[model samples]
Target: MEPGQLRVFAQYDRDLTLEADAVVVGSGPAGAVVAKELTDAGKSVVLVEEGPPFVPAEYEFDGGLSMARTMREGGLRTTSGTVMPTMQAVALGGGSLVNSAICNRAPAFILDRWCSDFELERTTRADLDPHYEAVAKFLGIAVTPENVLGRRNLLFRDGCDALGYHCEPMYRNVRGCRGSGECFTGCRSRAKQSMDISYIPAALRGGARVLTSVRIERVLAERWRATGVAGRVVTPFTGRPSHQVRIHAKLVVLAAGCTATPVLLQKSGNLANRSGQVGENLQFHPGVAIMGIFPELVNPRFGATQGYQSRHFLREGFKLETLWAPPAITAVRLPGSGMALKNRLADIPYSAIWDGIAVCNRSIGRVRVRRRSMDPILSWKLHPADVSVLAQALWVLSQIFFAAGARTIVPGVHGIAPELHSLEEAEVLRDRPIRATDLVLAGNHVFCTTRMHGDARLGVVDEMGRCHDFENLYIADTGIFPQCPAVNPMWTGMALAHRSAQQIAQQI
Candidate 1:
């Protein structure tokens, strides 16, 4: 059968029942990889997604409209304990559809720490190297071309060089990038190698079916073995349940995501939380942005969204990177009102934006399931040390801008001085008591909610992504990460999914 002939669950008018050798309850990088691998090995697979399949033409250039169409909770999902908004994509390809497209492999130090701290002996760098290579090749990963590195990225590089800090062009998973500076919104040119255009299509060609606009309500368990899943199709516009869906399979893979996967399990009466680790140990790479005003026209909105990142502070649990957003997003996040904001918007062409991402957050969070709607409720609080680190990172970012000859620096902090004109004023930011509410914080990467460990009491899954309580249930998302990987977790998450597929293939 042709790939386009695969069944879409939402098209059905009545209740449906399907059978597959494996059922994967997500369509992100991890779910896509798992579905593709299982089908390629001659197993019937069904990939379910809670979001719609967005064609390239349907993607919008406007940030607000794009977020409303693609992001979870219209990009307004926030934590309860802190003011940090969690930005996650809700589409067929998950965050890969809306991320910066940066693809960094798990750092060697992080892998070593996982092995030593979590006893993830099977997840060593050497063991996962081939999987990483395969994923990179499949995604067409390459360094952003220097010619396309717009003025904002160039300014960041200059600042890093002036400070003798180590910085390099980021490797991205794009094949024919046009430097549109719209990766966060969604790549309209089909240049971004997201899973929708990569693995999902391949899986379809291998006879795998995809069910979009459907939420997996629960995994059907039979005496500690996964039997399949039951869920309902949701209306694309209103996001309300419509048609009932039930799929029977020999195995079940939960790749929904860090936030949704645990919520699903909890709402299903904690099927996989025998060890009580279903929704614990959440770690997000909290980040803050700063804009530098340059004497020359920086034109931050005209190139790669994120082209370069500095590793100078990686050991300090933070990384500096250049970023860009459309005028609408940039205007709202500029930290001003009416006239002040208008003036800043007028100077958009001369401003360069960058972010210092705190990768080593000790602040643990949780994802609770709401009883009525089954939606996820996130709770997180920044550790005291994390607050200090964030302030230090902002200070460092200001210093970098000054070193790069910025005319003025607009720190994105809430109550801090609006603009720092000199090194002395920027230095004062280092001593200011920055509260959790004083900074504009956001995170896209979340992990460790259903972490993997050899010991059952320590984690919900094993090194191979198998749930400790169920023999045939598996998790193949960043939600199983032992801790924050201190880098973009896309490549690492895919590699882990590939490993999980291999293990499952062997078992079947």
Candidate 2:
């Protein structure tokens, strides 16, 4: 069968089978790029996604309902160790549909560490710069302009300036953003260059096919070669497994993401476990947010959801960034419910939330698959050392808030005072020993579930993203990173996918 049109499994009444030159799983950043590049190179490609296509106009505006509609597990997926919440988008565009569109390249230090520690060399800046440039140009990536940095985002710069630390506008994968601060709910204006609006459509135009609402259950393989994948169609509303699907192809690219990909591999009879690292070495850029109530109207609802950032403390194990969420979602985490919640909700416009993303590069974790179930169980804990880093970050944020003329700051640490009335009160947290359970945290940037290495015994895939055990099987997602890139993973993920797709094109 030729690859040329979009296919929605929900519309099918029976089993479906397809044949293509290449089959790419998950229509996220990595998979979309791989599919587009292969199709652009004249190969017939079929992209399969478990979730339906991301439809911007149909997105929920309220944060709570938005999560219910777009996020996997209704945004309730949490870590097994620390019990902190994490989010994974379930749409065709994946997290890009809900993310703030921050686009950052991997730092040189991270690349060097991967080269030295993980037996990687082809991932060096010299080898990947062109690919990164290509992806950036296509996505219209650039530093968020000042005009879009409304008062809420500008305050972050004010705080950094007052403290003599440099904070700059973030590079975002967006075009003509209107500062609606609605990035977390999906960009209704189609301004954010999410995969669905960019590469996925481009791939369709290039004759690549997409199948939505189809879950891949297993990999079909013989000896050392992958033949295809088999899965079931999913009913959208009830999420019931309905009809079946099978795709035969010469190449199979698994980009099911860091958290889900390993489970997919395990469910496929533990493929590529020679190194015993399919779901091992999981890492997260865990983040904590502090709310600052300004003396005046900071208008939290109006800004680029997150447009400014401070990477100055990266060596200190965390980086600070501005953040905002709808009042409904933010209210659920407040102290109380009834009128007390109403009072806090009234302060929404006067509050600004800035977050600290703990690099946690040295912290280790894992994702385990249950024997009887195919669901991935995340097992991660905030290390004591990383806990201290977050404490310092919170303290720094308090100081920054006060520096920017805020009256009081909410630290939200369980052991500490609930509200620090002044900057002097915040200094006590500078040396406070924070336990892992004392703070409410969340992580969305997950990495290293199937890392790449030069040696076949040490990693699941090679630097080129080909599985060590099979020439035609590839895994092109954040799972292949030896470590978290200490920033947003989308840009690096796309960069690597671009290079890997080129490599595959050359091979075929």
Candidate 3:
């Protein structure tokens, strides 16, 4: 049965069943792109989201409250192994709604490695660049304009230039960005072209039906064929099941993210796991930051959330980027309790924060699918090798800060001095051994939970993102990456989704 047009929320209010040509779960970047692609090709699509659509005006601006509205478990989700906090978005646009809008293509070397090392065939820059180009055009991606590169970012650029390292403005999916620097709390300006403000609308225009506030339980599969899905309407705030939901479709696309997708399959039983590779090779670009305190005020709050970066150190296992967040979040990392901490918080206007994301392909982990929970238990450790890389990263950033004329740098690593006063002191971080448990790190880029391979024995999906065990089941998100892309994964994930959509369109 055809569902009513446009938006349908939990307000639909009863047992609702819909049938369409395709059903795409998760209304984030990949799902939104695929919904538009299939709908534009004249296939009716139903896009399901577990979270409600967000309005910019409703943004609470408080970190805890904002997480309550946007993230799973109010941002308390964490990894069990080396112990760094992580979060998954529970909103319609996924992480795009809270992310800084940085956009980067997968590096050519990483793609080449995927084919050479992970059995990915015909997957290279040559094959994927067109899709990347299309996504860039559709999102209005461009370099962050200098007019909004406030002191914090400009200082990063200055540091890079002084250190003779290559640095450039970040490419972001925003139009007329007013640089309110509130990207994490939700872009108040609505200038950030997150999917809800971009592709989801296009999908709607193309006659796709969007159903929000529904949590998918399992694929409606029998005899290894995806028939449809069965789920229930969930109240986004209360997390309570309200009504029954069933969707029948010709094709099923899973874009429910790395952790959630595998857990969904686990709940569905024997689907997508013939090779037993559904949630095995989890990887994330774990990153840590250093705060540089300068005598001059940097006024860190008035620019793009992340506007400058250096790729010069990518081969060294990390990428350096300038970062900004509300003082409430940053101040916690400052040392001392009492008046000493007071002085530190008061110095926020004079400080700038920079971070390095380790290219962590070797630090493989697994997502433990909880049988009765929406959230998965992640077990990942920072490899000893990655620990050294993290140390080297902090050391390098400290050098850049000193070169840029900062008075002091706060490394924020445990088991080390709280503050570094000179270049000589910073050397200890790199020259000596540091445990992975010491670094305060977080991950936004996650990959490889449902990696694609040409060999059926080795991977959960094929090169075209089709599950090895099912004909019409496709996975189109970062989860299909054979390795972490080692950069922002949004733009690259969407490009791959477009490729999958094209493949499906041709076959159907």
Candidate 4:
């Protein structure tokens, strides 16, 4: 087999047989890397995905439909009585297709915290630098330059600078972007080098097989050993049901994700590891967007989703990220309807809105078992410290935008848009009461559910990414992160997958 030369085993055209050296579920960065490494090591490998292949020409500009099709739970917004329900992708390339393509490696401070708090080895910046470089090179990560930063992005940079915040160019997994600014939706320009264009093709070239649009219901375990996986094919568009299929494998790697991974584990009735931590310790960088109504058109739809950011408040458990929103979505996010909506939409092309994401880093959330089904009980509770940071971060974002000559600032929180004329109005938020629900938080980055730790009693997976109790089962997704990295996690996810795949290849 060569890259892009694998056969599509249709659901109706069944040819079931599984005796691979390793079976990797979910053909995202994690599964693709694992499969490629295993096949490169001369092991037979099978990769399974839950979404259709990405065709650049067929890509759309609307992120909403993309989120519904490529994300789990249709990117549902849930509050498990603790944390807000966030979005995670289920596309052929997983989150790579939907993310901002920021390829940030693990900061030394974060890695140090991992080493000191979790007692994991080989996670230091020096130890992991080569692996990080290899992953970055593989993804073709590059910094977004001045030519690519459109008016919308430059406006954000100006605001950050005027506020005395450290802002820099972000590295993305893109080759030759034309600055269409539609990275959240599928990239029609074929600039964003997601796993669909990178590792998955390489894996297929190395004789790895891929099966898409198939849902894994449960892992078949025989006396604590994973022997096979069973699931049904999700019919296209019509929501029709289909028959179940079983894949037998000598080794099984679970890259389903933080929420789905533990559910699959619990469904197998293999709860041997009674640490009760397989699905706990979930983390998400709860973000809030500040929409500033500027006199000039911040036609935010003109460039990358996040090209610049404000890191002045990073030590305060939050960072300011400028995000993009299509005009239609931005209309709905406004405070009022009718005349007000028309007024905002009329100037949509000229409106320059500065979006800010308040990165929440101090909260610990979890996933619990629900009924007999494998649906995760998503729950999260924000610490008071995180709430305070969000307040301060939002205040700073508003002040900066105002200093940049903004008229009104619409906080993404679900209340009346705070029509601020001056920075003093923004300062009141610091003392005002803030609640988790009051802020507009999203689940775009869910991590640390099945964390990697040195102790068996504390973490679900070891530093090598193998499960604490199950020998053949492994976790190679965001679920395995011990803590949420301060920046975009896709690159870190890929690097960690590379490291884990190497370990799995050596053993299997």
Candidate 5:
């Protein structure tokens, strides 16, 4: 069935009530997978999303407009005690609609650690292989074609090779990609195979209904069992509350990403946080970028935004990847004022940027609900060890840039020299006392806010993602990850949701 044939309610203005065997909050990767799998098993499902449906034609390539219409908090959400921004998309497909389409399976070591730490004997890598394979096949996951790798990506690969480090082409869920380097904004060509184009459509075809522009305020429970959800429909353009809405289902699945899920549960009078762990242990793959001034034009915005990555330092809690953004976002990250800034803007075509991501950081954060409100108060503090790891990553990125024949490198650190000409000068960066305020940090991956474990005292859900306190309530997002997966969490989160859906089907 075509997408147009799906039952999507986007502009219902009157009070409404929906009923299903399972109602999934959030139409992201996890919720889409769960809905599709359950519908495939002949169960009725309803996928609810807080944001409106946006097609590729609606994308105008304007960063500010895109954020205002599709992103959470108009892309201005930040941690309470720090300047670090927590990026999350609030569309029908959630982050999958705006992300770079990178797909990576969880590493074996990370899976092993999760199994041991969470006592999830049934969640071994072997147990998850089939689910991962299914998701990959469904999404057409493959190594990005060599022709689409832009010059910036090749430069990063050349630098890694010159330094005897390994860099590989990233796997993405795209077909016929034009390499427009606009994935961070929505994909205007619709070439990228996001959840909206893949799983959600399949679910819709298989009898699942999707309701967009509906905010779920609370999960309705009766006698320790999830009965439904209640909320209101908001105006698509302004997000102003408009009409009351309710969804009653035999089972409820919460897949509203890391931040929204915990906050929703907490705001509902701690419905499923029996262990006091609903909004704790939040971890993110915090990343910082280094810009190299090359002599020739790089045209960073001409190809796939992210096409290559190096995990050579994965065990050390960091990874390296090449990234490109539109001139507006790039200018915001570039440091300068007056003439200095103007000069850098003019040199955008000659600048090459790559990110050093600290994936296994020990930093811990939390999400708390403000009294009498649905908003979340998020806070995170980087540990000393994690700060040192970021410093090491900076040193490594500088070396790679220099090896690739960059004349000057600009480490985007506050209270430091703007430009470094030699490795000796870059060495000073390794010793500088790194502070969260001194670095430009961004995180899109969030996990472990409502972790899953066998021990109810330490986790909110069990190994199968079923809430320990309620038989009919389950979680199917990265928020239930036992620990940080040390990689892009999309594929793993979808695979876990598939498993959870299978479990729920068997019980039903």
Candidate 6:
């Protein structure tokens, strides 16, 4: 399909099928990059996605409703007997639509560790620097400016300075962003530079067709060669039901994120045992929040969700990032009954909040493909080290609030009231141990389920992002990230997608 060409619809009842030189599943950051790269190399491409198309300007600025429509499984519920909530976007732009605009590359120290300990070659930051630079330029990545740091973000930086914890404004992917603080619910101004606005648009302009509201079930394989896929396209408006449609292609690329990609490989059956590592070693950078009462109207919802982050404790297995939520969401976390509710609601606009995100250095999980349900089973077990890291990070955050002259500070743990009044009160929190379920955590940065590596026995994909036992099939999503970066995972995911796309373009 070329630009400005006629439309092509794939209907199920008509046994309508389409053939292409390459088929890309999932229209997020990875798939968009892959499709554009392949098509630019003169290969015909077709992209399939399961969620509705989102025009950034068309989406209302409602957090809850937008999250329900764009996020997967209403933000996947962990089945690991822990309340460790994690969320990911399922729309055409994938997580890029519902993520904080912060765009940090994978930390250098983490990459060094992966290469040194895991023996991953050609995976160093130096080797990937050109790719990162290109991606950053394409997304228009830039650091948050001082003028855009709203009062709440300012307070976070001021508190960090007072407490001797280093903090600086993080970089973001945006063009003329007005600091609306609505990144979680999809950028309403269309300035946030999500994949929908950047890569996907460029891909479509380069003559690639994207089909929304299409759910890919499995990769069609024959004699270890992945020829195409079998799936369905629901009615765009009603979404009642539809028949099946199979797509034949010379190449298949999987960009279905950490959960879906692994399950697809496992469900394919022929590809599972070959690597024997699909759906294993899932990693999530669990996040938590802290709120402090301020004398002025801080309006925590005015700037970037995570503009400033603390790097003081990065070596301690914890990374602190500043974040806040909408009034309704934050109200549910505040402590109180009668008098407390009255006091809290009155200070909702004035409350100063900062999220402390912990990128666990040791926690691991698994995603199992259930035969009965199409959705994959998600399970995460928190390690002892993760719990200890949470405790240390919380204590540090509390001390910073106290230093900043906050009289009351609320911890993110469930059922835990504000624990700090004076510096003396904050000292007691350092002694308290945080349990796995006690800490409230939710992060969308997940990876490693379908990790790529040099050895096939330990991972699902090779370093080139190709599946082990299948020819002409590749995984380009975060699932192929062998190690989870201590910071946000989008930049790393996009860069790897670009690399994988180049490899596929060369072969085809």
lDDT of 1 by residue, 1-508 (tens): 2332444544668877888889999899999999999988888888888888888788888888888889878888888898688877779999899888998888888888898998778788898999999888888899999888888898889998999989999999998888889898788878999888999999988888888888889888877888999999887746888789999999999999999899888877788898888999988999899888989887776788999998788788888899988678886777678888888778778998889888755898888887777568898889989988888889889988988989998887877788889889888789878898888888888999999998998999999999999889999999999999888899999999999999888777
Candidates' lDDT values, in order?
Answer: 0.87, 0.87, 0.89, 0.74, 0.86, 0.76
lDDT of 6 at 61: 61
User: What does each candidate score in C-alpha RMSD?
Assistant: 1.4, 1.4, 1.2, 2.4, 1.9, 2.3
- Model 3 residue 321 CA deviation (Å) reads 0.4
| Backbone steric clashes in candidate 2, count | 0
Q: Can you tell me which runs of candidate 5 are displaced by over 4 Å?
A: 1-10
State candidate 5's TM-score: 0.97
lDDT of 3 by residue, 1-508 (tens): 3433554463666898888889999988999999999988988899999988889887877778888789988888889877888888888888899999999998899899999987887789898999999999999999999999899999999989998999999999999899899999889899999999999988888888888888999899879789898898888777888788999988899999998899888888847998899889999999999999998988898999999999898887889999988668888789889988898888899999999998998899998777578789899988998888888899899999999989888999888888888889888777778888788899978899999998999899988889999989999989999998878889989999999999988765
lDDT score, candidate 4, position 329: 58
Give model 3 RMSD, 1 decimal.
1.2
Model 2 lDDT tens row, 1-508:
3457887754778888999889998988999999999999999999998888767667888887889888888888999888788888888888888899998888888788899998887788877889989999999999998988888789889999999987889999999998888899989888999998999999999999899888888988888899999998886534679888999999999998898889988888788778888999999998888888888998777779899999888777788999887777766556656886678777778889899998886678899887755468989877888888888888888888899988877777888876688888888778677888888888999999999989889899999899999899999999999988888889999999999999888876
Which pairs clash in model 6? none
Q: Per-residue lDDT for 323 in model 5?
A: 89
TM-score of each: 0.97, 0.97, 0.98, 0.93, 0.97, 0.94
lDDT string for model 6 (1-508, tens) is: 3441222233334544778888898877888888878878888888887776677655656557666667766654555745566776777788888787777787788888777765578888987788788888888898888777788788888889987888889888887767788887777778788877788777777777677677788788889789898887765433444767678999899998788887777777636446667887888888777788876778777877668888788877777777766566678777768996777777777777776667765788888987755477888887878877777887888877777767778775654446456667665556666678887777577888888877777777777788877768999988887777777778888888888888998888
User: At residue 425, what lDDT does model 5 achieve?
Assistant: 86
Error of 5 at 499 (Å): 1.0
Per-candidate clashes, comma-separated: 0, 0, 0, 11, 0, 0
> Model 1's lDDT to the true fold?
0.87
Backbone clash pairs for candidate 1 read none
lDDT of 4 by residue, 1-508 (tens): 2322453425346634556778888887777778888888888887877666767765656656655666666667575655565876777877787777887776788889888999898888887777778887877888887787777678777877886778887788888877777787777778888888888888887888777767777787788778878876666433344656678887789888777788777776745356678778888877766777778766566677677766666655666776776555567666667787677667566545554444455677777767855567887887777777777777877877887778777776654344555677666666678887787666577788889889888998887788887888888898888988877777777778888888878877
Candidate 5 shows a clash count of 0
Error of 6 at 455 (Å): 0.9
